[model samples]
Target: MTEFGYFLSSEEHGPQALIEQARMAEQAGFTSLWISDHFHPWTAEQGQSPFVWSVIGALSEAVSLPVQTAVTCPTRRIHPVVTAQAAATSSVMLDGRFRLGVGSGEALNESVLGDEWPEAAVRLEMLEEAVQIMRRLFRGEQVSHRGRHFTVQNARLYTLPGEPVPIDVSAFGPQAAEIAGRIGDGFITMAPVPEAIERFRRSGGGTKPVAAGLKVCWALDRDEAVQTAHRLWASEQLPGELSQILPTPRHIEQANELVTPERVAEHITCGSDADAHAAALREYVDAGFDTVYVNQIGPDQQGFFDFYRTKVLPQLNGA
Candidate 1:
């Protein structure tokens, strides 16, 4: 069965709010959780970005649902060795209910440490090496690596869960999907693109679970929902490579000037209709995604959760 999950927006919420959301999501019948890891929000209007590891630590105590980083960039800002250790500890804390989701990363979060942003191709290379190193560390063995992008000497993870934590790799295109197939336990993406899924399966993804996420604004007033989505998530409407290349929240805010409320509504599902929300989620399910995570775009998380629990999820689950 395809599992429905909740996407916790670290960029828009503090740690406590996220913990509460996790609890409520579980109560609302969300079977799993996906949380974004970012050093900074996409735009200043979105506001808060908390330390993801700290939040995950709290989540271990608050929620019973399995959790995964929607996507974390282990290639930059933080070294892969440290990421491996953190993920291992999280797995332990969650009693083996954690998965590590990683990707090539964006300049918005990765460049904050004053490192020059590499090209996409170079970033992929770094990610491959980082994944290799992390996999070794997860095996509870000392690791020594001298690679093109990073190095480690006698690094080991002592606090690991009983089972190895699965690594889910995020990809938007054919090349990254192929890499995910070869190295990842699962695959993650934002869009429900069949071509990407085909590439992943053909390249080596095989029977691994494929996950996707979408954001919606759920409110009684459709117009108000549209405004909320545009105000808080207009950065999402920025086209092409801008989402990947923009280095700061301010840069995203400037680019998002071109994104209007109409455009945001067109791209993101908004408004109060339960059938519409279910239909939006169905697109991902119909695309053969084994997991679909839905995120509510604004502060009215309770309203969204209650709607999904009482009206949306029952229909989807029964279907």
Candidate 2:
């Protein structure tokens, strides 16, 4: 069965609010959770970026649902060895209910550490090496690595879950999809693109779970929802590689000036039409995603949960 999950927006909500949201999501029938790891929000209007590891620690205490980092970049801002330790501890805290989702990363989060952003190919190379190092550490073995991108000496994870933590790789195109297939336990992507899914499968992803996420706004007023989504998530509409390459929230906000409310309405599912929300989710399901996560764009998280419990999730479960 395809599992429905909640996408926790670390960029938009405070840590306590996110913990509450996770509890609410489980009550509302969300089977899992996808949390973003970021140093900053995509736009300043969204206005919050708490340390994701701290929040994950809190989530373990507050919710029973399985959690995964929607995608964390282990190559740049933090070293892969450190990431391995964090992921290992998180698995223990969650009692082996954690998966690590990794990717090449965005400049919005990584550039904050004052490192020059590498090209996509170079980043992918770094990510591959990082994944290898992490996998070794997860095995409870001392690791020594001298690679083209990173170095590690006698690194080991003291704490580990009973089972090895699964790594889900995020990809936007075929090349990354192939890499995910070769190295990842699962695959993650934002869009419901069949070609990408097929590429992953053909490249060796096989029957492993594929996950996708969507953003919506649930409100009584459709126009108000649109405005809220545009105000808080217009940066999402910036085209091409901008989402990955842009270095700061301010830069994202400047580029998002071209994203009008109408555009936001056209893309993001907004308003309280349960059928509309279900249809939006169905796209990812139809594309063969085994896991789908929905992120509410603004602050009506409670209302969204209630709506999903009453009107949306039932239909999706039935479907």
Candidate 3:
């Protein structure tokens, strides 16, 4: 079954607001949740970036649905030992219903600590090493690793989950997908590219769950929704490696100038047409994703939820 999930936008909502949204998602029939882990929002217009671990703790208390970090970068901004501890604590709090979704990461968030960002190949290598260290820590073993990219001295987590947290790797390219398959418990991507999924399966992913997240704007007026999506997420449309290499929101905003409203409208599912939204989600389902998470853009959160609850989800789920 292709489960429907809601993507909590940590970049757009405060911690309390995110908790409330999680509750609403559960009530509205979403099967799971995906929250982003970011040190910084992509652009200033999006506004909020709470500590994801704190938000996850509150979510454990607020919703029974499973949760996963849409993706967290364990390589640079935080050590894998600390990330492991945080993830283990989160999994215990959620009653072993949490997943640690990881990636090589982007400079917009990872570069904040003034560390020079490594290139893609190095970043992926560091990520592989970090995952090994984290898996050891999750087993309540004291880990002392002195690797090429990191060092951990006799670090152990006392508070642990009943089971080791599953780490899902996010990849958009073949190289990252290969790494994800070779090392990840599962695979994640933004688009519904069957070839990438096939590559992952061949590389080593096998039958592990595959998940993807997509954004939609559910405004009553199509043009209004398009403008909101364009203003808030234009940076997402930047070409090539710009998203991974950009150092700050300001630089990202400057780069966002290249994305036009027409492009956003063409690419994003906007407006109140239920069929359109259903069709958009169907594309991912058709691509063989086990789970698809949808994020509603702009301030019409309640409206989007209501629309999905009444019109879209029923159609998708065949309820």
Candidate 4:
């Protein structure tokens, strides 16, 4: 069966709010959780970026649902050794319910520590090495590695869960999906494009679960929801390599100015219609994703959860 999960947006909420939202998600009949990991918000208007590890720690105590980082970048900004340690601790805290979702990363978050953001090809290469290193450490063994992009010496983790944390790789395009299939325990993506999923399977993804996410705005007023989505998430509408290359929220905001509200409405589900929300999520389910996550674009957390619990999820479940 396909599982529906709530996506906790770290860029738009603080640690406490995120934890509270996780609890709300659990109470709302969702089966799992996906939380974004970022050092910065895509745009300033979104106004928040909490350290995801800290939030995960709190979440382990606050909720019972399984949780995964929708995607974390272990290649830069943080080292794989540290990431493995954090994920191990999280898995133990969550009673073996944690999965480490990772990717090649974006310049928007990875460029903050004076590290030059490498091109996409180089980033993917680094991601492969990083995952290799992380898996080695997850085995509770000491690791020493000297690689093209990173070097580690005598690194070992003491705190570990009973099982090695599963790493799901995030990909956007066919080439990246192929890489993800080669390296990941599962797949993480946003769009419901069957071609990408098929390419991944052909490239070795096989029956490993494919996970996806989408954002929607829920409000009594559709127009108001559209304005809110455009105001806070217009950066999402920026096309091409723009999202991967932009280094700062200001640069993102400048680019997002070109994304009009009409365009935002064109892509995002807005307003109180239960069928619209159910239909949006069903696209991912129909496309063969084993797990689908959804994020509420604005502050109507109660309404979004309530709507899904009472109206949307029932429809999706054919009740």
CA lDDT scores, all candidates in order: 0.93, 0.93, 0.94, 0.92
Query: RMSD in angstroms, candidate 3?
Result: 0.9
Worst 10 residues of 4 by lDDT: 310-319
Where model 3 places Cα greater than 4 Å from the true spot, the runs are: none
C-alpha TM-score for every candidate = 0.99, 0.98, 0.99, 0.98
In Å, residue 125's CA in model 4 sits off its true spot by 0.3
lDDT of 1 by residue, 158-252 (tens): 99999888999999977899999899999999997888888888888999899999999999999999999999999888888898999989999
Error of 3 at 112 (Å): 1.0
For model 4, state the Cα shift of residue 287 in Å: 0.2
Kindly list the per-residue Cα lDDT of model 3 for residues 78-110, writing each as its tens digit. 989889989999999999999999999999999
Clash pairs for candidate 1? none
lDDT of 4 by residue, 175-286 (tens): 8999989999999999989998998898999999899999999998999999999999998788998999999999998899799999999999999998898889889988
Please tell me which predicted candidate would have the highest lDDT against the true structure: 3
